[model samples]
Target: MLYQSFSGDAEVGTSIFTMNGGSLTAAIGPLFYITNTDSIIELKDADLTAMSGTLLTASADRWGNNGSNGGVVTLKAENETLDGSITCDSISSVTVMLQNSTVLEGSMNAENTAGSMA
Candidate 1:
């Protein structure tokens, strides 16, 4: 049970986070709060659960900075289990891919604007 947060406060326009063979339960979150235009989260042979709110969230800043807000996010789960929902802003997009016995126990939302695709 590790307590941590992965924020998209990097200089790169694209933020990618990958993990394999483990269990990740949100201490408190959307688990992933990303503001990058291109955000990718990949989990293989792992477990991700969210007890409240959402599992992954994509949009503008957590702050009031809506300058470069909204983009596309790709979530890849292979031979894993996911237990939560996903949220994509009205101007953003969220794409989910499940493969090889991957299980999704929740819903997802994708806004899919002109600049983005779900």
Candidate 2:
């Protein structure tokens, strides 16, 4: 998939890279990345779990048919679930730009926190 940034800010940067895509049955680990500015990203469900046996996976997709809107994809329920724990490590800081449809009504654990929207 393609991950595009909607924000036009100068200090903003977005990335859509597939770290791993093989088999969820194999051993898995935490997925980590870095952000320097404010932005919104989305991941779609495109048979990404087919080869990996992942009932729940992270894939970027177009938001509301608006590629520039900058929204996030929701992974509520699916075929496969996350295999293990999630760890986030950051050196400086990060910002979370949440849109109206993007909801995180659950618990989250992280390190080196920064910005958020409610």
Candidate 3:
């Protein structure tokens, strides 16, 4: 699907946000805040351009009751640009496809023990 303007936190709880051959443009608040353990956010063959807020994963305290499992953000898209940051703080993981080209204008912090961006 194509999203013109996306605002607020999209708390994905054990669910998937699949951008299939489309684009999602963030115009206001943070695009996503993964709060559920083992939740996935998949961007497949798509594009995401952030005009405003960041795309952030949750912390241990925010990860529901089962914070040990952590969450994953899979970027399978061809291209992506973040005007804001993409943060995964010690309780989340992000996998970016080798073929994808991603640009971050702000800052990205993947500093948790379990958090990784690769």
| Tens digits of lDDT, candidate 3, 1-118 | 1111113355434455666667677676566655434445656455666555575544444323554645566644345554566666575676654346655556566333446776
TM-scores of all models?
A: 0.75, 0.26, 0.55
**Which candidate has the highest TM-score of all?**
1
Best by lDDT: 1
- Backbone clashes counted, model 2: 9
* Residues 1-118, model 1: lDDT tens digits: 1111235443545667899987777778777766635777888987676768577777765433365566567888899777777776666677888889998776676333334434
Could you give candidate 2's per-residue lDDT for residues 1-118 as a string of tens digits? Answer: 2233435533334443332224323323223222232222332221222223222222223422332233222222223233322222222222333333443332332332312212
Off by over 4 Å in 1: 1-10, 62-67, 110-117
Write out the backbone clash pairs for model 3: 90-112
List the global CA lDDT of all models. Answer: 0.67, 0.29, 0.53
In model 2, the runs with Cα more than 4 Å from the true position are: 1-27, 35-40, 43-90, 105-118
Count backbone clashes in candidate 3.
Answer: 1
